[model samples]
Target: MSAIRFEIKLHSCNDRFNNPAVRSPLVVEVDLSGPRLANDLFFVLHDDTTGRTRLSSRLTGLGLAAAVLGELMLIGRVTVELTDGWVGLALVDAAPTGDTLTQTALDHIIAEPSHRFRIWLQFLARTAYTDVAARMTADGLLHPPRGRLSRRRAPVLANTAAWPGGRLNLAIQRRQPLNLQDGVLLGLLVATSGGQLVLWDQNPTYLSASTAALPAPLQELIAQTEAAVADSVISRR
Candidate 1:
């Protein structure tokens, strides 16, 4: 199967983020066409090597829910409304998403358009992590570890799950222009405060710009995710 490729060209700019080499219309071709956005986000958040995330389940679940919302928005099934300081969501298309999880989410949004974004995030976070993990297991991206030791040895697990993180890490390190999916990946990382794990040891310049490149809806989603997680942390303290 031929993988889909995206070519992103960076025009000359005076921003401190762009290195000299990338200033002259640099073109970057990247193949970020693996799993869908939500699946890829779950794999990146779950530590395949350790079978756990460094962050709390609360944060990871919120991030996963946000990612799924992002996927829905990308396919025109949903939209985030940011009017003034208020943020909420609405269903764009009543057509079935062809996936149960997202379809259910859309249904909820359709049923009650008044619920704020944070409310939906908290509600979905209740199950997004486990649900996505189960989906990945069914799709062959993860193998249910049989025991403590099987965490590392499970077939079709770690390597596949780790690929998304490694791929995004390399993109930041190499200062490549990120596609929409990759941009969202990085944004979600920073949103979940997991940037230090993957964005660590890279040039902060282009990496910052890459995330800032996300479209309006996505940028709003990440911003809301960050705020929601912050509130959770504060309440815990």
Candidate 2:
């Protein structure tokens, strides 16, 4: 059987933070192909202080859906890939060293047994620490919590039952053009995933004090979408 090889790439771009000015955006790429291959990736970004996430993404295939769903039910962990061939996974924490990619980091991510989605989310959370620092230099008021460090052990799905509570109420405005059902789905995902989710509300007055500190452009974008959705709902009535 052939091995399912995984490769990762990280890119950085200059932002506002830095003495002479040195910052960059980080991008990650993952690849996998093999017999009976299941490729599922999940990314999560959390604010250290609130233990809440600003964003999350999931990628996966069909065969493993049962396992993934099972894991989510029991522990929120899913099996990302299972091939008769050799399997490989990679993790790259790009922020700390700047322009550095290490094989050891990749080796660690591959060795984990948790679903690919969880691994990706963990990687994003870890890397965000450095990314946020760089972001702060450009906008001091745009502060989010730093990412947390996982213990050096095998990765596992987080237990939603034991997760912390969320202070922010996710209000999906109808104006964003998102279907009411779809908006509800997003809310359900976040609620079930535990308290790490926050809905993007366009009303500045509605935003939490913490999020309100972000740049005006970002604030407007968040609100405009929500407002659009809200208006849509009103029109139907």
Candidate 3:
């Protein structure tokens, strides 16, 4: 239910970058190595048919937040700890994440004295959509409508079927082993929304098998986040 609140917070944001929009124009920074976790989630969550996102901003936000956290976990930038019977985040190495969005998530966790996962999830989820979308747009992976008339519309990507998300979904569906980064990506996607939004004809059994391939700690984290996402979606339905 608290997870549902996280989704609601993300959906309620009408202007994703208003607070940070006035800063400057976007500059392209293609990783070439691969899409960042947030960018991959954006590509996966986008709706090709509608030129909008398939998942609500909330779900997308939570997914992105989870992705950011997962990325950090993979890089040894952060880790979770049990405190007073609650799982909270702990800083591992304060080194820069290179990517701004991931750094922001790290900064948020570091700045706040409290480390509750849900609290950080809610904050990052609410903010990640705009940051990730802007990065994708800058990278030429997505095309956001221009002009004041389309200002309120959500961003969309073209030829999404050819994007990295397609490969990720294929890997999951085929139950193929993924490298650490992809494994984290798949686990985060599955955890946040059961990969329903990302994959067509989602098979629960297949998802379970794919998830089971993750490292034990990552598996537990994803499973917890997945339960929260499920509760949020079910409540809305």
lDDT of each: 0.71, 0.27, 0.62
Assess the local accuracy of residue 191 in candidate 2 as a C-alpha lDDT between 0 and 100.
25
Top model by TM-score, which number? Answer: 1
Clashing pairs in 1: none
lDDT score for residue 136 of model 3 = 69
Error of 1 at 120 (Å): 0.8
lDDT of 1 by residue, 199-222 (tens): 545567776687667555566778
Q: Tell me the number of clashing residue pairs for each predicted model.
A: 0, 24, 0
Candidate 3 per-residue C-alpha lDDT over 1-237 given as tens digits, one digit per residue, 9 for 90 to 100: 111000000111222213233222222122336556666666666664444666777777887878778777766666655556666776767888777777877888888847677777777777777777777677776667667665223435456524657787677667677765566677777776636656764767766666666544455457657766877789889
**lDDT of residue 23 for candidate 3:** 20
| Candidate 2 runs further than 4 Å off | 1-117, 140-237
| Candidate 1: regions farther than 4 A off | 1-33, 83-85, 145-155
Give, for candidate 1, the lowest lDDT window spanning 10 residues.
5-14
- Relative to the true structure, candidate 2 reaches a TM of 0.22
Candidate 2 lDDT, tens digit per residue, 17-117? Answer: 22122122212121212101011111122333333434321211111221122212111112223223222122232222111222223333446544343
